[model samples]
Target chain A: AQTVTQSQPEMSVQEAETVTLSCTYDTSESDYYLFWYKQPPSRQMILVIRQEAYKQQNATENRFSVNFQKAAKSFSLKISDSQLGDAAMYFCASGANSKLTFGKGITLSVRP
Target chain B: NAGVTQTPKFRILKIGQSMTLQCTQDMNHNYMYWYRQDPGMGLKLIYYSVGAGITDKGEVPNGYNVSRSTTEDFPLRLELAAPSQTSVYFCASSQWTSGGPAYNEQFFGPGTRLTVL
Candidate 1:
């Protein structure tokens, strides 16, 4: 079974600071995809970033980036220069075989 | 484009009641998916469809059903509501590729919050 784990339930970061949300996944499939999604208080699920397992280079989308260590099975999301709008629930997911498995998610609080 | 949209932003159901969650996409995406997010938890896949008339079970399909009768619509049915079924339901759609599903980035709807008593 494919499983994604986000150990931290909650995280807080001061505005303009950087915060890294930890996520680890286990999958037998060699070729898969990893994603980080952000859900704001409005209950909308927004895609933050994505990384392909075959790619050695990490993925970055503006202020959001991923440190994807395939060998270690770790896919952590880093929010640089975090702003108040960055506050939300973050989810880590693994996609393989036409299915996606998501972690428990971490609630991010941006302190102004 | 509307991308993906789900009807009934919020609904409440009593035990043993039934309801259908409607989902639609305007992007002409061939892949549609239903997922439920429990409190303090990430989203769990309930069902998915690669195309019209073809649906498959996902990670958590129990007590839930889905049908894909057209390319634009995928409605999820709950035959009997239970408290355990209370969660925020999300509908997602993605463009299909011959290569595989890994390359597709799913677009999600605003989500429907369902509460079963």
Candidate 2:
């Protein structure tokens, strides 16, 4: 069984600043996928970024990027130039065989 | 495209009551999943179907049942509602391929909020 852990329950970032949400997982599979999902008040889950465990390079999408350290079993999400719209609950998930295990989630607050 | 659609955006049921939550996907996806989200807790997989006729239990499958009679529809049934079942349920679908990009990503529905009293 795989488990994802997000140590931070709440995080706040000033507008235009950067914020990083920490995530760690326990999995023995070498070939897997890590993902970060955002859920706003609308309760719609949206994909933020994804990283393949085999890839040494981190994954970056617009202002969202992941610091994936496979050896350390750590995958953290970094949100740059944070805006008010970035206020949401962020989830870290890992998947293999189409099944995903998610962390408890971190509530992000972008303050202006 | 409607993507993934879940009916009855909100519902409240008393103890021992039974209800079915309907889910439909227009993407013609072969894989569908049901998950429940609790406050401060991440989403937990309740059930999943690889195809129309195959269904499997997930981490939290107790008190819930699912059927996938058609490719587009995967409905979850609660035979006897309980307060512990109160949570937001999400329906998701993804195209399955032995090795492909779409296999890793899942499209999710708006979610249905259910309350059991």
Best DockQ among the predictions, by candidate number: 1
Candidate 2 residue pairs in backbone clash: none
Off by over 4 Å in 2: B99-103
What does the lDDT read for residue A26 in candidate 2? Answer: 95
lDDT of 2 by residue, B1-117 (tens): 999999999999999999999999999999999999997889999999999999999999999999999999999999989999999999999987767652369999999999999
Candidate 1 CA-lDDT value: 0.93
Candidate 2 chain B — worst ten consecutive residues by lDDT sum?
A: B95-104
Question: Tens digit of lDDT per residue, candidate 1, span B9-80?
Answer: 999999999999999999999889999999999889899999999999987899998989899999999998
lDDT of 2 at B99: 70
**Residue A50 deviation, candidate 2, in Å?**
0.5
**How would the docking of model 2 be graded?**
medium
lDDT of all predictions, in order shown?
0.93, 0.94
For candidate 2, the per-residue lDDT at B38 reads 90
For model 1 the local lDDT of residue A73 reads: 96
